[model samples]
Target: MSLKQESPDESLKSQIYTFCRQIANSRPIISVCLCDGSMRAFFGGTKALLEFLLIIKGFKPRLMNYVRFFDDRPAIFYAVDRWVFEKDVDVGFLGEAFAVHLIFPYTPLVNAGYLRAKEVKLKKRLILELLENLVLTFPELSREIRIKPEYFVYESMLNRARLFPPMYNTLSHFFQNEVCEQNFNRVMEGYLIALKELEKEGLVECENGFYKISKSFIENFKSRKTLFTNLFRSAQKALFMSLLGAFPKVLGVLSERADILLKFQFFEKG
Candidate 1:
């Protein structure tokens, strides 16, 4: 049973169970992703972002009623959980999905003239998660996947274009310390290779300096998440991890779009 878009609660729970059952019967777990889009679909709006998050985090559900993001992109948050993957998480349905949500190799923000802010990280994690899923599902690419660690660095930097303008320095200052000239250039080279690999797999369409993920990738990602595993964790849990570390708004998707539930956003649209 292939998975479809966010559906009614009945369809969501049924499909989720089916996917989980399959993973349980398979080999080592591969990938686990979270999306902001799925969160909106499940909870219905960003108004509940904080409320639902609190509930999931053992907070008083009613007390969280005041939290809200109210951004764009269906304000949906979604993600999937995989046990062990060989390489990438190319759910095809990359952005707006949780799989590509938490992993921001660099700062993530969507500003004027820069639509794709998290492209680099998105590509890297998407491929890694997808490869992981495929490896667990197909058992091939296991060795090849490991050989291309550079693939992630390259893919994660491709979307840096969205770093300027309205977002300006606000975004760069956050990640500037993490990336220097040497390391940044290395990541750029990796981005090129990763883009090449993605194009070969029909995941994205690329021009001279710009790139875009194919709709098929999005659809496949949704299907894999729907038909394969259950989403137990969320961006909220991952980011706002008070027990572990401080959770800052490094990834703008969570801030720009409020409907996203982070990790727990993959429930059939309720």
Candidate 2:
């Protein structure tokens, strides 16, 4: 069944319940994935499942609470056995429902700037946790996803922007770094050009003077690939050129490091 933003009706709940029970009885690993902003069943080997579990290690109890108690909140809930997933404990939802909660922000914090200082501080903490989970889950699967370097830069800008104090006076701070600080105008010019390119591509948009990532970007991120796969080869090339032209030295060093890492992986396999 296709998952959507609609509230869970009684029939949908029953189907999910049955599906969970059947899978728990037979499968050794059960995972739920958010796809196109909806929850659906996901299957993976033991290692992938374990890696995903590590990313979400601490959020299980809260997620189980969300599942056990029905709320008017528009969410899809699924139940799976903790014993089946973890092998030792007969406890919670085995991190099933939490994936939905953690991955998708129910409401995008677009006006984060308007929030009070204390409120912004609290939001930053939560955003950081979400960011950590997201980073941990993706690196191992990045190869399979074929995430291009330019998209990585685009995603980094959005994430880094989220970490900044929303009240900061200028968006240029989003591009600030040791490299940018040293070659300020050059790096800033390149990043701004790249940012505008990303905006043109619709992966990000300017909202309240902040860059708000698109739902399509989030979906691609959730899947660990597949955002602009068939669509943006030319745009991706343009983005790479923008970065390469702006930071040739830095990109050169990065390329060398990547080559070394790739060689090491090959050595291990060989």
Candidate 3:
């Protein structure tokens, strides 16, 4: 469709409806990921996101920028426009504690935006530590799976970056099937869709394949860092700047701490 302004609330709902028509058309078992929490896990891979990530990976000519964040609870609503979620493969590592939010283009939730919700909980910090340690200490996950931790940390540092893959595709990698590109499309598609809407609203613009975070998300984020405003929001503003400041230091500290693991692995492998 054409672009339009997107409100955070609307973006949230449209993302949920994505899977209704696309995923429901698939096998009934695939639809089960809708049980809750399942949708959240799947968000890790989508092409809309890869557009920029392709940059972190050294892909050039990309202009749009996006941010990736995972809170304690994460959910993803899959939309295919054609393919429906059909099955849930057996999986371990993450255990039965997880699920997916599957849908088909026909699912009413596509129009309504909540076919299902997946219950997924992950401490984002813990994940950063885990991936940092793994890349630092061990051999890469596999030759096919790039082990240069820096390139792929934005979305998944571990788990389906494959400490845990989707329950459906968890074991597929062992046999050599690849979903990296397809999954990338699925995850990014939602944002791309949202971007389209946001552009129509004139909140932001895109050139080539990249998108600009509507000034709204950025302006709101910047308010916390504003040193001088009405002077009334100092406390509020400080909180955001403090957080912005901490983000870099925290990442640097972890990288330095984890670099020790990298050094040891490097010499040993050499």
Best by lDDT: 1
Candidate 3 lDDT over residue span 1-270, tens digit each: 211222324453454334232233332212222221122223333221110001011112111111222221222222221111111112111121221122111122222232222111122222222333333344233111232222222333233323222322322321233444444343334434444555676544565554333445344434454334323332432343243323322332333244332332211111
Whole-structure CA lDDT of model 3: 0.28
Worst 10 residues of 1 by lDDT: 50-59
> What TM-score should be assigned to candidate 1?
0.27
- The most accurate candidate by TM-score is 1
lDDT of model 3, residue 94: 18
Tens digits of lDDT, candidate 1, 40-68: 34434333222111101112211111222
The global Cα lDDT (0 to 1) of model 1 is 0.34
RMSD of 1: 18.7
Cα TM-score per model: 0.27, 0.21, 0.26
lDDT minimum window of 10 residues, candidate 2:
43-52
Error of 1 at 199 (Å): 1.8
Ranking by TM-score: 1, 3, 2
Model 2 / residue 140 / CA error / Å: 20
lDDT of all predictions: 0.34, 0.31, 0.28
